[model samples]
Target chain A: MSLTRLAIKSLLLRPARTLLTIVSVAASVAVLFSLLSFNSGYQEGLQKQMQQMGVHLMVVPIGCPYEAASLVLEGGEIENYLNESVAEEIAGMEGVAIAAPSLMHAIVRPEDGRTDIYLGVDEKHLELKNWWRLNDGEKPGPGLLSEDDAVLLGWDAALIEKREAIGERIWVPEIESEFSVTGILEPTGTQDDGFFYVPLRTAQEQFGLEGKITAVQVRLTDPSMAAEVADALDARFAGVEIIRMEELLGSMTALMDSARALIFAIVAVVIAISGVGVLNTMLMSVFERTREIGVLRATGAGRLHIFSLVWTETLALTVIGGVTGLGLAAVAARGVEAVIKRFVPMAPQEAMTRFDPHAALICVLAILGVGLVAGIYPSLRAAQIRTIEALRSE
Target chain B: MAIRNLWRSYERGSETVHALAEFDLTVQPGEMVGIVGRSGSGKTTLLNQIGCLDRPTTGQVIIAGTDVTALPERELVAFRRDHIGFIFQLFYLLPTLSVAENVGMPMLFARAHDRERVRAICERVGLADQMTALPGSLDGGDMQRVAIARALVNDPALLLADEPTGRLERQARDEVLDIFDDLRADGLAIVMATHDLEQAARCGRVIELRDGRRLEHAYEDSWPKAHCAT
Candidate 1:
């Protein structure tokens, strides 16, 4: 019998096991791609968010690095503060071009109000630092408490307060301080969407803390001078620390790199395991089809012919499994796209979530290689089976 | 003589099987012989050795002047394709292929044979009508006819049949016997292994084997069976 027909029949003989192997390998590979998506997507989002907003330095209070980092990144608590004078002091420093003082604090939801909203900083210097271009409303005025009676809501902040932009009044519960929404910023999949922005004086007054703020961000005259400015600031301000944007990015990227490495290791191990799976399945098939192979051998099929019959069969099975797995993954990505759409309407494009076709092709080629190599030794074994033994194997 | 020094062969293990012990056989350019033996009589093993599907451990198996017993496995395959035809009891037709494909299989592998000869063999087997049908759909007699066509596709010099009538009923067996008679009339050399004495009686000569040796050769029967051999 020709190897093509033989292989197809052999694989089709045990439909469930072959399909199960296909699904298992596909799942492992999909998970690998999922990790790829997460690491690259997250890293891309962070860099893109930073690129859009050109803030180069972030100065926060000493101790509690993770929490403070999260606060500035994901708006973890909005409840810390640094002096407004610090911005002025840093602005006079040699390499510093602009020092923007920002207040970040939280207030309890109003007792009678139906939402659990908190008030975060909405500083002019903070907005200028982030280049917070608005979709609506005017910029905050440039005086202490100048915009204290007003606020700007981000996409998620508006949902939190259950209010709309342009003339919605909300009260802060813990301090009985009230403000109106004056501006709304666009969605960027960054921290801005979760916090409310207001004047530093207004946040201090509302939270009942005076002369205190969270972080003082500095912009350098030259972008390359950021590390030097950060070092100088760290030396100048005792009990305070300076963080360059690049450093924050490097560590975040490192965390993602570790995840990438982990997935790489997992993919290698699973492929090896599947190689054994291919071998076992083909071996059983070879044993069962001994009589058939012998018949062919007796009919003048050469050793190469016998070997190719085995090799082709192995190739066909693995390639079918690989393709089916990828097809399922394509369907799975649609589901993931839908879930992400429900959360971030202006999320990154769906193409961003797709696996690169080359990578996908590589996965398929890897699967084919796994199948054939896995079958190579077994095929040779089948070829070595004597014609008499094969004919008599019964 | 194509070859000489032929001897008996056996495969031994714990069972001590003697497939072809102390047996001397010969085939000239044109001859039709019938071999009759009971199960375990080694008729099929003897055919396998002559067919080059196996090598005799101690005997010399020469086919068309080539010492096939000592030939390498690759050349042995080529030897079988080039010189021998095999007909099995189960009618080993590939189920997925059409009748024509099955007939074309040996020719395709042999490759040295003419393609028109393959078409002519199918026509001779009376399978021209059923050439497009797969083996799965053919009746027993027609299937045997296809098997005969496959055996004749390469126009091989030596035809070996191992109980070709064993799987068929009396009518189908008789139909297959008719084809064998025709081939003998056409002067094709045939060695058929069968368990039925009545079928053996129809051939030009009958050789009865026991204990892996030829017990008797009824050459006188050829006078009466001469009409079948034409």
Candidate 2:
């Protein structure tokens, strides 16, 4: 019978208390895991989204910058647009490498109630989006759209509306018109993978807005001069908002930083409470076994032995709880991700509830540390007991 | 084992209580020394010093030819582990462990891992049939027997028992005394503290204590009775 066995047996003697303590510690650990993983996933998702967009500056009508960015970058309802002439003006600006304009509209098919995104762009828009590749069929020619009504389907759109999409016309109930699919765009693993593309002039004609557009995506010749160029453009276009990509990234990072701080605070409180719970349980055990400890001492056992018994019991409880909590976190994270996707369709398609090995290791080490600290006071109390005094205790 | 001028005192608030003062005694191998005293007579204090469970405020306790009183706590613990065993008045068996597990505790502490010795000692104490039973299921006499088995499991040279049969019936008390006699016959030293004058008279030497000091006429010629068959 090692001290470990003795400790385990002691805990088993009071099975109810032992189980309750384990559950308490496990609940705290699960909360910590969930919060930490969410923070990591949220930050990683935002960074990927920003990096994949591949634009330095966005020019949008005043008060519609957010709505325009959400539509182009996340694919959703849009009720705003800029004049088509704004794209030409921005293209002729100094230090501007490419100024691509696009118009975004969504139509719901009555047959399935599924919404489809229609993004109208000029020939320069394709060149500006360097990641876009033609998977099959034909690429559009270099010009604004004409009366031909040719369209290119996004990878996801092509898959959903397969066969009927290629070399066949798909009806748009909103506009009461039909357009021929000329090509299929390859999967870019971005917001663009779920949209349909048509020439800018065709969208303008179909929508009865001959000179209107949605937003202008600007690529700078020198990326470092983005702030200066954006300021110059902001001054020239008083009715538009010129947002630098770096500024947008910085604001998003700041928002996530605040969220991370709140989560970290919550984790700290939970760890502290669990630590106290461990201490309370061990102290109660010691109090109940005071005379038993005295007997052990009288029978050639030492203070170190008493200390080890109490500490071992605490460690066993915490370790079991921590492992169970981690397993629960892994399972709960998947459900949480699903709930987030159901409510927010624009959420990152990649897993947003990540539990990497590094995070898991840190969580385990931290819980063990809590166990050690929590066990200290009770173990010390056990070690300091006088054999005669303890035996004399009723 | 010998004690020399051992004194133990405590400060209870503003008053000082001297539990033991100038306590001195000696016992040879195969000796059964009984300590007789009233409630505040310091017999328990003497046993504590000799067992190395506590340090005396003043004086020396020499066990196995070493001054255990002078040894540090760490060394004293190891010394106790190798040489001494103790049986208590209440028979403080762990309620959770089986009789065998309770008896095996001393060997476990010694890291001996000798299952045979534990079984042999349990059998010697007549608890072989109750090896797998928890202490709660055992009677007072059986519980005391388990404590005795635990004490002897480590095969220590000295055993200190405080009121070993205090809670047992007359028949059970006689059984415990018989076991003590058998232990003494096997060349192991034994020290017992008891209020039972009949049990004290059966020892090779009896020491009486009062006001933390030894009485001169503790042993008498008439103490040994014909009915005592040790």
Candidate 3:
């Protein structure tokens, strides 16, 4: 018979105890992997969300520091406007690739009869945009919104409308506009989802303001020159505030990194508890089988054979536990994602919240290592047992 | 093989209990010798020392020209596996192993020249059809036979049987004696520990012990009335 069969049968001799230990260790691995997955998912989701908002630079109309920063960083309502012509002057400078200007505005209606909408401009001056990628159809053509007919909406905006209204006109009662829905943008789980799109001229004209734009989005052909581009734009635009997308991405990344580290520290303690369980099980088996060990020694089994048998038994249990734990963690991760959505609604919808196979593999190997080392003390004690005394023990 | 002035003890804690005092023993190759003693007597201890299961405190146990007492613990294990076979009162068969497995245990571990020969010997012990049966289901006599099969399978220079018949009834005891007769006829040296006088008398020689010291020696010529004792 194979050594594995021997180990499994040996463990089966005390079926209840062995199974309990396996479960305990497995639970530990599951907890560790689950926490690890959660941390990674959050970090990944946060980074993806930030990147989706458009990277590299944010140029806003400057005034009060918090207002301008809030307007550029978070999605602040129309406080001031940065003109479109000023963008052209910045674009002619070095380190700029594709520049698109947009007017950012929010329409608040009653959530409980409070206005609850954030609208955006999809204009001809920025129609061939760098960041507003079209996942479904072509961007609304020039003058699509000029005739007060067509509009492009985000996916969540369409979902909130309570039906399939593409190719039909939908009304945003808060803004009090009746615009035809041409297409739905893909879900990016950012401010993009919370906003609607109309031609920039239409938005300016509707808001009773003319010859005005919000801020310019500039993508550097070389990402490494983002800081240089931000500084140059700041120098050229007088009162305009330049917020580099790199800085925003860095802050978001830092928040996620700290959160992940916190979760991993907690999981480490849980894993250490599980390691103790493995050690306890091996120790108990050695204690009960002292006579059997002596018989094996008498039967000409070497010290290494004794060591291997014991180590294999523990290692086998750990592997079984690790794999089972992974299965449970994945099942739980689905529920966790649902809960996370209830709180952080902007978690990247495309980013999966599930146990990672790469991380699970590493956890399995680490547990097996723990198993081998755990069995050593017990195996040595078993090996050192004097055969004559062991055989003669009652 | 000869053991002169053999001494041994079992010290668990503060208590030092003498297991065997001074003992003198001799047995030629292919001879069957029975060791008889009471419950507390060192019959088992004497057998254990010669079986290489224990060491003499102050004497020598010479088996096949090697004083096993002087060998290292590692080599001692090798010596025990290769040169000796054991049959215990409890029929200490590996419960997980089949009858064939139990019979083949010593031979398998011995790294012997012929494994099929061991199976052939197992068949001679009357377990020819029950080779696949686990020990838990076997009767007392059959279990003894399995242990005996293991003891003789490796064809060791010395066969040690400790109270092999103690766990059996009179009929099963007689059955075991019948198998021992075949072993003796094949000229395999066998030493058995027994409390039964009839079992001991059937051997070519019998040594009685009490309190770890040898008390009497009864050879076939000395026990002229052994046939009548049964």
Displacement of the residue A72 alpha carbon in candidate 3, Å: 12
Task: Give lDDT: candidate 3, residue A248.
Answer: 64
Report the C-alpha displacement of residue A33, candidate 1, in angstroms. 5.2
* Candidate 3: residue A284 Cα off by (Å): 2.4
lDDT of 2 by residue, A230-336 (tens): 98898888778777888777787787777778778888999999999999999998998888888888887888888888899899989999998888889888876
Model 1: chain B TM-score vs. truth? 0.87
Q: Model 2 off-target regions past 4 Å? A: A51-119, A122-147, A152-196, A200-244, A334-351, B10-17, B218-230
lDDT of each: 0.70, 0.83, 0.72
Residue-level lDDT of model 3, residues B1-230, one tens digit each, is 78988889779799988888888887887788888778879887787788776778988888888888888877787787777778878887767777877677655445553657756977898888898898889999999999888777766778888888988999999999988887777767788888877787788887777888887644444552454454
CAPRI band of model 3? acceptable
* Clash count of each predicted structure: 10, 0, 9
Comparison by TM-score, 1 against 2, better one:
2
Q: Which ranges in model 1 have alpha carbons more than 4 Å from their true place?
A: A1-6, A9-56, A59-151, A154-165, A168-180, A186-241, A334-353, B1-3, B8-17, B107-119, B184-187, B216-230
What fraction of the true Cα-Cα contacts (under 8 Å, chains A to B) does candidate 3 also have? 0.27
**Top of the candidates by DockQ:** 2
* Candidate 3 lDDT (Cα, 0 to 1): 0.72
Top-scoring candidate (TM-score): 3
Residue A3 in model 2: lDDT: 79
Q: Lowest summed-lDDT stretch of 10 residues in model 3 chain A?
A: A110-119
